[model samples]
Target: MSGAATSPASAPALVLASTSPRRRELLARIGLVPARLAAPDIDETPLKGERPRDYVARLAEGKARAVSRASDEVVLAGDTTVAAGRRILEKPVDEADLRDMLALLSGRRHRVWSGICVIGRDDRVRVRIVDTIVAFKVLSAEEIDAYVACGEGMGKAGGYAIQGRAETFVRFLSGSHSNVVGLPLFETRALLTSVGVPLG
Candidate 1:
């Protein structure tokens, strides 16, 4: 007797290798929803004297590689870095750290680097790095304290979230605004599309 016929193969699934809700939100803005969410737990520590751009790129690639999936599936990952000159500002571990980061960014132009990595079904990896220049207004002591008290900077790079109350502090911004919020939608969309991910 002949065996039951198998179903036709389906398109490769799109996996988002991140735990950040902001990224999912950003993807929603472009009407693309990941078929699966795989949060990779790879070492995110910066290498010895790693530049901000390189640091983000490495982490994004690492995250995309860490997720386990079928060969036909696609994985997407991203990393955001806040840089003051050559210094990389990571997420704040405490209120003091948050305050310090705010002070350092006050009335200064800093760089926000976002790296996106997309691994295709054929294991071909594509990366895009986006850099944004953000200028902060001169912040008063009260302003810093108030912002810190809000507790929005706890897990945010550079101890701030531009999409939140921190928007008032930005005097000028030159580049993708979405990058500062954790993902670059335009770059991300282009990367996914290039890798055969369907979008509306």
Candidate 2:
């Protein structure tokens, strides 16, 4: 006889292993509020010569593994990376760094890579990497300086937040918009449903 599908009530509660407000908000949009928030503390330093895609995937899985959870709880984690060619533009440390990142992205096409990891109650791990191509219009020196002065990209990857003021700078974007915001909704829903998380 075939195995029966897992019932929603029988599934474990979801634990989000991230402190990102954007991730939390995105989850709320799908009515999948997490049972608990477990921010994973780990070294996010990229390995020597690690590529952008690998970097994000490793971090997401690492975050999922770092969070403590009960056998009856599923864990979810995600990581986003902005890559200009092979270089990974991480969160800017200061205004100067933000300026530099924006300048590099000016009039250029870059890739936004978001990696999502879901750990089921049975300890099985599922991962998906979503890539979005984004192109920015030619930014003038004045524009970069003004945007940096606003201090919006301080903690955002690639020194910009797509859902904020930076959206005006985008000339073209092709891929999951939610992924650029921090989490990919379609992919996240699929992952959660696979683990028997109630989406409705």
Choose the strongest candidate by lDDT.
2
Error of 2 at 15 (Å): 0.4
Q: Rate the local accuracy (lDDT) of all candidates.
A: 0.93, 0.94
RMSD of each: 3.5, 3.3
How well is each residue in 1-200 modelled by candidate 1, as lDDT tens digits? 99999997566778999878999999999987888899898888888899999999999999999999787788999999899998999999899999999999999999999999999987888999999999999999999999999998899999999889999999999999999999999999898887777786
Q: Model 1, residue 68: displacement in angstroms?
A: 0.7
Per-residue lDDT of candidate 2, residues 72-154 (tens digit) = 89999999999999999999999999999999999999999999999997789899999999999999999999899888899
lDDT of 2: 0.94
Task: Mark the 10 consecutive residues where model 1 has the least summed lDDT.
Answer: 8-17
Off by over 4 Å in 1: 1-10
What TM-score, to 2 decimals, does candidate 1 have? Answer: 0.94
